[model samples]
Target: MSNIVLKRWKRTEGVVNESYTHSDGHHDQSTQLSEVTLTGHLGREAQSPIEMTKSAGEAASNGGDDSHLPNTLTEDNRNEGEAGGGVSPCCNWSWMVVLGATLLMCCILSAFRCMGMAEVVEVTVAWGEVDPTFVLLRCRQLLTNIISSCFGIIFSPFLLQLHTSSTTITIIYSVLQFMWNSSGLFVGPLVEEFNWRKVAMVSSFLSSCSFILSAFATSPWQLLLSFSILGGFCYGLMTSLSYLIIPHYFTRWRGVANACVVAGIGIGQMIGPILVEFLQKEYGYVGGTLLMGAVLFHACIGASLLRPIQNQTITNTSVQLVEPESRTSGVVTAEKKWTTVAIRIFLCVCRNIVTNFSVLKSRRAVIIAIGGLLTFNSWLNFIALIPFAVQAAGHPLQAASTCVIVSAVCNLVTCLAVSMLSDWSKFSMKGACMTSTAVIAASTFAFSVVTDIWWQKIIMGMWGCGVGSYMGIYGLTIAYYMGVHSLDATLGVTQLLIGLGFITIGPIIGVIRDASDSYTFSIWVLAGLAACSFILWIFMPNTTQHSHTTPLSPIT
Candidate 1:
């Protein structure tokens, strides 16, 4: 009985061990099946999304895959969240659009600048019957310099042909100069509120109409009404717009970009004389004036190219939210409360003006403005004095004009080269400006002593180099010192000071020429001013030496 019981126990124990082994095998198989199912589902879901994202990215990139785009979009999307949908804050196309707008602006500005200084002499010579008095000639020189420097160019063949008195023309031109300078104050707010393209289009239309209408003017006042008032106002708008647009497009290459755009002045100066000379020769002044008006119509095409940037659009939207409610109110509400709305608008404008003027409190801005005042004063004197000096030295009007063209060509080359140097080398904007001022001073002193025509031409070329360097770096220096945020206000204030110099100094130089019977005194005075500018530069601050990669912040 004991043997039988022991066998039963052994049998039961073996059976239990076999059952346990079977259960463990089934558990291992189930676990493997579950792992396979999960991997299959994950592959199905993730594969499509990855492939879709890759294809969409490729399509957006056009041809090549840009590694930078992914990171940029990621960062932008993170910042902006779902509302932006991974859109970049600034696109590749933005810089291209800015470049195209800059080219257009160059064309318009070239036409404007060329028409003022170079074409005036051609028009005066072409209309032979008009005998302008000394005062009239002096006034014309003064007004032309003032108007052109302030970014307005006016030419009415009718004024010279109709035998208008120099006094009347002078008065009209002065009023026009004032109008052009004052128009700038309104441009900053307008550009910030509306699309720049729209502003440019309106300006182009007014400019074109002004030029076309001046061709048919029968009296001096009519000419002034068309050319001086209408044209000057529109041209001022265009000039201010050009300066404002540049900073938005570039950062590291700002100096080179500005140089290229400003070089349009040289191009216009080179082309204007030849074109006007040909037109006057082939067609009379009336036909020439009419054709020039047609040429100006092309500015509208340029204006159409100015597209808004993404960052600027964002800024505009934020500003609109804070703007006076009257501007966005219903027509009936605005009409019922017209006086209140008007008061709000006036207060808004005044507030904006004060805000813009706040940039002047910066020590860097003050230094630049003072330096620019002296430099521009000397520049105006050079423009007015060079032609007279050449004439007094027994050269013809053509020779003087040729000298102007030469100076412009030299200016174009020098600006491009110097800007390139500034970008590539360790040279600071302030250092370049100081060196340029010194060169100008030396050149001006040379002009005071030199009597030979050939030597004068050489001196003029050196002077052009100095002027080009100054103009090329002026905006960049402002960006360097006062920061990019303050560029618009700094430019506006600096231009106003320069305009004052053009208006005051040109007439004073004219009086000096009449009294002294020589440009020796005038040239010496300009040299002294240029030297003073250099001295001012030496005392100003230099913030670019250390931390070259860090951007300068604007003064509060």
Candidate 2:
């Protein structure tokens, strides 16, 4: 004999709490907004809007079961129960995970922001002095370390000789950006093969080595090997890892947790310029690069703190392997059995790859991807070229650094503000994304036209706002269009596409500078590219109304 007690409760602040008491001496409680609770031994709580719909569908298919509640658990719910068991217990330690991830990201952003674009003007001048064969033009682009055009500025008389140098330098920067963005294509699979902690630690070590190697680079090609190829790949791995791990530990606080992790970039941006500037002043570029290498090594510590959690997919596979086979079945050969297992694993991987690609089937996701590709270089180009542009307009490097600092502050403030508002149903993340893109476009154009130091600073501040807003909402925007289940795959696929775009578009920007003898036109072209994304995003369909918070479910 069994009994079940169901109670309908009042809604409180848009959330409804339902409690179920079972004769098995267990209580099931769920907290959601405007959703009916299903009956089971231990009723599992649905975490997101998608899960809510799924729960409702499952309940309806079983005839609502209000009068005669089912005694047995469904296979799907049982599996969920097992998986949720591992994650639910780790929420207490989630904040610690955030702290560790924050440290890792802070190091990456500091090194990349400082070494990539912020210090490119000074570093380019220093590098050109060491290798006088290449013409030193005004440092044009520094995003991903675009440094050769800066050489032309120092040796304008040798502009004719800059074609090779500019192209080669652009290639180096392009490869770095390419690897950084495109690595996402396979990073998802790599994470699944080996947990996030191992991937992050190994990558962080490689990144440190890359930076140390950069300190001893004799020519552009050496920088290419150390900084562009190796460093970029490692950075990409950690970047994807940091974003992917947050959902594993967070459910209700997903938005805030993500914001905290991403805020590391803003914090790094603010610190990188000042730190690198001091290091550059005290020690030359070589010494600075070496010390920065040390600073980046700490990421290994942060990566180590990511405690491993149970993988439900792996658990399911283990269960199948141990299931007893019919004794009447003929014995299988060792070689044949191994081959069969390998084939099964390969097929499973292929299926996962296909599913990852399916996110593109959504028209809105495609638009977002295209928009990302078109404007991929906006932030990089704007930040990278500004210092060189400032110096071109007869301002000091200090003034340029000041502008970068101002932008960084604004970026941090705006990012935090947007993150705080993430749970607000009234706040439209898509609109914020579009508005930020437009602001970046306008600021890029204005900064290119106005050479006045004060005006440039003001323009930089505005650009910082746009940068902050975009960074704050980047992940949320992707999940918004593709759904939470597809977040990791979408990031991997979208970044892979944008990485390819850098390969083609990066060189063209360099050539434009070489041909026209100025970065103004390149800036204009970037602005136009940003505008293109803004226009495309305008057509994106509205998503179902819900708070844009990441659910606790593992991204499959």
Candidate 3:
């Protein structure tokens, strides 16, 4: 008789279903045990679902259960059972339908958000009518993104599951966005007239009735309450939720999945501003909120599609769920080439971090931390300070904006190139970290010493490249250094340090700028800090030293 045992693990640990192979075909003649009977990843002991809480820290590369498989998984499937009927060309096309609807839902959500972006610009803040302070419209966007990003990342892991994660996350995103629409347009002003409690009540009411009300108030504090209370709750929940779902279904196509979602942001930003303008112009800002509310109410229609993953159980082993005829095949299908590539890229990145640091075993934790601190600080400062620096250096606002746009585009392109380069060169993530540090320092020096507009533009472009590349590299290094499974925690810890870096940098740079008659000295000081940061990164060791350079094992 075959034996089975279960194990407790964070879902990211993909090996819950380890298969043991015999040296000889010892069981070839035994009564054939159906592979479908041994469906789950068994461990030494069965673990209750409740015990599967997430592991703490930047522990290791992680993976979790993939519910369906068409071919040999692990080069073996453990038993002799007939493959399921789903793979037969004549099989019904239902799975494709499920997948099709899901992709459509995702696309709609992306497009609506894009329209809303353009709409936000049209909101005429009665700056002249009220307290008369105008927070630059674009500044709020950056802040919203920051706040949403932090919140989304932290909440994302919690949303993962065999089913329902995507839908739950979508509802949360829609609801929060609806609330944001109301406040940014109207409730924000109304609250300026009342107490904080009243503001809170009004904001909550608008969120509850967003399908009906759509509105904000007057004072900045009113805006803060709406955003912090309603916005904070929603933003934190959705950001992480958005990225993880595609990985669940399509590990091989992580890049494509990520691209699809990111494309949503680009689309949303474009449309949102336009929507805001239309609403504000057609019926006053108040009417705009109401119009937006009308738009938001329709989203709940899509929410119904976010259901539990189909309760699928195949009595046969090795089912290949194929849907060539269905509309959803592309969105729902799996292609192994990219997944294999992903695994290799992962290996390549891990090898780099380990070989460069030379502390894989004894100093695993330390190296990951060092990677987090300097890398995040050096790169994250792009939006935080670089633009400010350019403004201080006497450049036009458009020039600063152009540099940011170009750099972001470059980073997107390098997301693939750098991953491949690291694999090809076999340079430790350590090298990448150090190179970024050097770039930051060099760029900082150039910014400080150069005065001519042309030179400054060149310097900005150089600094922007560092800024862009570092952002993507930092995420990749953190994943490989700590483990993809602990990516959320790695990101969190990195942010903690980054937050500190921002606090220290803002004032130091500001004070230096103010104290000196010109920004020259301040730029040099920033460069010096970059140099100090790079030196600190030198001691960071590779976590892979602790294990063979595969994805780091999940912390037990």
Q: Which 10 consecutive residues of model 3 have the lowest summed lDDT?
A: 66-75
Model 1, span 283-390: residue lDDT tens: 766676677777777777767766633211111112234346656566665465666645654665455545665555555667788898898778656766666667
RMSD of 2: 11.5
Off by over 4 Å in 1: 1-91, 113-156, 276-291, 309-347, 395-399, 544-556
**If scored against the real structure, what TM-score would every candidate get?**
0.70, 0.67, 0.51
Model 2's alpha-carbon lDDT is 0.61
Q: Model 2: which ten-residue window has the lowest total lDDT?
A: 145-154
Summarize candidate 2's per-residue lDDT along 186-255 as a digit string, tens digits.
6565554334666789999999999899778666777778877898888888887777667545544556
Report lDDT (Cα) of residue 55, candidate 3: 25
Q: Model 2 off-target regions past 4 Å? A: 1-89, 116-168, 212-223, 270-294, 308-355, 391-397, 513-520, 545-556
The candidate that wins on TM-score is 1
Cα lDDT over the full model 3: 0.37
- As for candidate 1, its clashing pairs are none
